[model samples]
Target: MRGFTVIWLGQLVSMLGTGMTNFALSFYIFEQTGQASALTIAIFCFVAPSIILSPLAGALVDRWNRKVVIIMTDLAAGIVTLVWLTIVLTNGNLEMWQIYLGNIITGAFNAMQFPAFSAAVSLMIPKEQFARAAGMLDFAGAASNILAPAFAGALLGTFGLVPIMLVDVITFLFAILAVLVVHMPQPAAEMIPEGNKRPSLREDSLFGFKYIRERPSLLGLQFVFTALNFISAFGAIIATPMILARTGNSAASLATVQSIAAFGGVAGGLIMSTWGGPKRKVQGVLLGMSAENLLGPIVIGLAKAVPGWAAGSFMSQLFIPIINGSNQAIWQSKVPPAIQGRVFATRRMIAQISFPVAVLIAGPLADKVFEPAMSSDGWAAAIFGPIVGTGAGAGMSLMILLSGIVGVVIGLVGYSIPALRDVEDIMPDFDALTAPIVNNEPAIQSQGE
Candidate 1:
């Protein structure tokens, strides 16, 4: 736990620095290009590589030293930031292509960083503390979300992007130093028998999907998240536009709603960290999701003012940490530490694949279908106009409301499935199966073992 705490603190600092840089870069691109598409493309460059490379990266994480993976990836990302800083200083300007390329490179490194860090945590902390550790991680994210933009906005207006990139690079160095000081445990199973051949990369990469497929409970859990991410995407993409359109493009209103909502996540993370979530982890995942949808999107969809939007946003963000922490704990407990990198990476890939798809379609659904239908004299006006009102953001609000309804139904349906509901009872904990030695030391037996 001490080792993990040190690493966690370092990573938290790194996240803050990285978040600031991201904020600065986003503003830079938008300011320079004056095109939303430019910003969107930059984001796509950053996110797409990670998703595409996750499986291979996870396989590599399992095969290599996890600590080394973390250090190297952080170092590489830092180098990328350093290069960006150098370029900015030398040329006094950055091209869009350069930014996109940097994002792609950093995103690729992140593919390895996340799985390595996640797998390392499972080894460093006691099994029972997984949820708490996850909560702490979420807390770091929430804190970064709240602080980064504010800091970046101030710095960008004064010192500019160079200072932000320098800070990011320094944070990476600090993170690497933290790892250097810690004694990271390695699973004995990762060490192959003397004469056995190592598995092929293809086999290793595919292993996670195969492992999840063989476990009905794990597969069911993945399905639930996939559906949830898809539904959640609708609100995520449209929330800003809906708020702005309804408020006549009031940035102040949007900021107020977002800042308050981010606070909810911070509060939720704190509570989860202290409480360590529910005894029934599945309920923590399912019921939390249900509550999140009911309280968040549904309320936001029905609301007509900033207060209502803020309230809905806050409630929605509040449950995110609980749901994520519980789900992560379940995966950590169920999967063997040796294979967790691949399994967890695959889990992430599966769970997140829906969001981009939904993002792409959500706009058209709002512009072409829902908004038109809900227009003052549009076809849906007769039916839904009275409830959601007619005009600009109304159709998007209806889409959000529908997404929430479906999200709630998905959570409820997940609980009704015996495999998913009784997942904890049905699947034995990995520690109970075999007492694997760590760091080449003697195996420490679990109580069940």
Candidate 2:
């Protein structure tokens, strides 16, 4: 099979496996002990390790053989998941730290897999097709997300997490096999000198950062969305749950909403596959932001008041693949193959920082401010009394509106920023993809820092 074809298949299978693991694990931990903090710790364990190691992972990816990196990570992940599956099968005693440890290790492996995959994409796919490929990848992920919860429930109730984990293990094994079968050429001579003693893995990883330094625009482009990511986290996770609680939405309804949202991703991906995204893919990003700005928060806010939550989640989700697909195309076209792994890895690392912080603040805000503000005759009643309104879950509604306002303002700011809003004009190179060398070998150093 062609490298891209193999990769696309691997991604689809792996995403489904991952989605199942996520659903099963979250449900398992929550059902075991309803403490919110347990879940929080689990999340922190999973995410924090990855965050801490991203810089190192990117650098290593640039220096290492991309295919080898991918295979190794998959192999390790499969082994680890297998072990976890056995623990689940035995119905042995489980501990919080054990779950955390498992989460942290898996997350680290996942982080390593990203750079390798992104860099590989740069080597394998037609530049113009980047968006379409991304759309497909996004769609697969979204579809998997939709199926995971229901699948997890079935597996858990019948055979439990062990059986589900066995499936995950098999998925990882297949993913590794896919990578093993593909051929990936190496970096350019220009990027890695002909005879200079090969640098240590750490030094190679840092090359990604250096590459970014050479191109300031790429660095800046990554930064433009930092604020948006930070704020969106709060609205996406915290706000929805709080508002839903206020509404008559049941647990199953919330899960249904979550599952339905994936269809939007499917639509976006299918559309991009056919449309190949906009002429200037950056416009897709901007458009996505604009849509998220206006639609997402409004849906979350009114979910309680209107029946929109019944369908809004799906509607909003539809935009995700559209935006994600466009972003992938833009990156693929601009970044050189050699450096793509490191650069994309570094990019992901920086972008993800907002999530933890956002979650931290979000938990408190929903608990303290948003929830109480609109409560019957609460704080807002005394001040913005007329603004929020009387009764009828005004606070949650107000929070949603404010979230939308924040998203819109952020989009406007992005529009104003010359480098970000007008990235296509400045980085016009994305419009053109020239085959630079024989064998489609990687030509750029990976980005890491």
Candidate 3:
């Protein structure tokens, strides 16, 4: 716990720095282009490469030292930030291409960093404390979200983007230093039977998919989250545009709404860390999703003012920590530490695969389809105009509304599935496996039966 605590603190600072930079960059881009497509494209560049390469990176993380993986990836990301700073200092201007390139490079590194950090945490913490530990991690992210926008907003007005980038580079250095001083345990080497060869890298990479496919409960949970991610991306991607459009492109209003929404995440994380979650962790996940969808986008779509948007945003983020923390605890307990990196990576890739696709389409959907339809004289005006009103952001609002409704349905449908509902009970904890470390693979009964 002590080692985990130190790492958590350092990562917290790093996240804050990164968040500040992201906020500043997003604002700058949006203010310049005033286009949702540009922002979505930038986000796509950052996410697509990571999702595509997660399996290979996961395999490498399992084979390499976890601490080293974390250190190197963090260092790489820091160097990328430094390069951007240098370009900004020298050139006195940044092009969209530079931002896209940097995002691509750092995204590749994150594919390795995430799984390694998750696997390392599993080794460091006790099984019973998994949920609490996950809560703390979420808390770190939530705290960053809460602080970044406010700090970035003030600094961007006073000092500019250079200072924010410098802070990000410094925080990355602090994170690397923290990792340098900590001791991380490695998974024991697998023992091969006489005349039997070890698994190849391809086999190792594919193992995570194979393992999940054989477990009905785990597979069910993955499908639910995959759908959730896909549906949620539509609304999430368009949120900034919706707010800006409604507020006549007011940056202060956008910042206020974002900060308030992040406060909800911070509060949720604090509660989860202290009280843990429901006894049935799946309940926490499903119920949280339902509550969030009902309270968040639905309300936002109905509102035309900053207060309403802020309220909706707050509710939208409040349950995120509970959903994520509970879900993470389940995975950490069910999967043995030895293969967690690959399994978690595969899990992440599958769960988030829809996100990039949704992001890619969200901009077009909002800008082309929905917005025009919801216009005063557009086709959709007769049907949805009375509810959401006919205007510039009305079509995007309709899309957000539909997304929330579908998200609620997804949660409700997940609850109806017995496998996902009883995943914790259906699958034994890693410690309870008969041969938990057989050939560096978990030896558990396949729930496919």
Q: Per-residue lDDT of 85-122 in model 2, one digit per residue for the tens?
A: 77756766457677888878877877888777777777
lDDT tens string, model 3, 1-449? Answer: 99999999999999999998998888878787888888999999989988889999988998889999999999999998999999989997678999999999999999998899999999898977888888888888888988888988889877878999999999999999999999998876643333455668998899789889988899889888999999999988898888887778776888899889988888888888887888899998987888889999888888778888889888887788899889998999999887898999999998999999999999998888999898899999999998888887888888888999999999999998888889989999987876644445544432210
Clashes of each: 0, 12, 0
What local distance difference test score does each model get? Answer: 0.83, 0.67, 0.87
Error of 1 at 116 (Å): 0.8
TM-score of each: 0.86, 0.84, 0.95
Model 3 clash count equals 0
Give the runs in model 3 whose Cα sits over 4 Å from its true position: 191-195, 437-449
Order of candidate numbers by lDDT, starting with the best: 3, 1, 2
| Residue 101 lDDT (model 2) | 86
| Candidate 2 lDDT for residue 392 | 40
**Model 1, poorest ten-residue lDDT window?**
440-449
- Model 2 segments beyond 4 Å from truth? 32-37, 91-93, 157-159, 190-203, 239-251, 305-307, 372-378, 381-401, 428-449
Over all chains combined, what TM-score does candidate 1 have?
0.86
TM-score of 3: 0.95
- Top TM-score hit: 3
List, residue by residue over 1-449, the lDDT tens digit for candidate 1.
89999998888898888877876786677567643346556766777788778899999998889999999999988999999999999998789999999989988888898889999999898998999999998888777767776777677877888888888899889989999999999875564433445568998898789888888998999989999998988887678667766777554566567667878888988989999999999999988899999999999988878999889988998899999999999999989888889988898888877766776677667767888898888999898887778898898888888889888999999999999999999888987866553323454332210
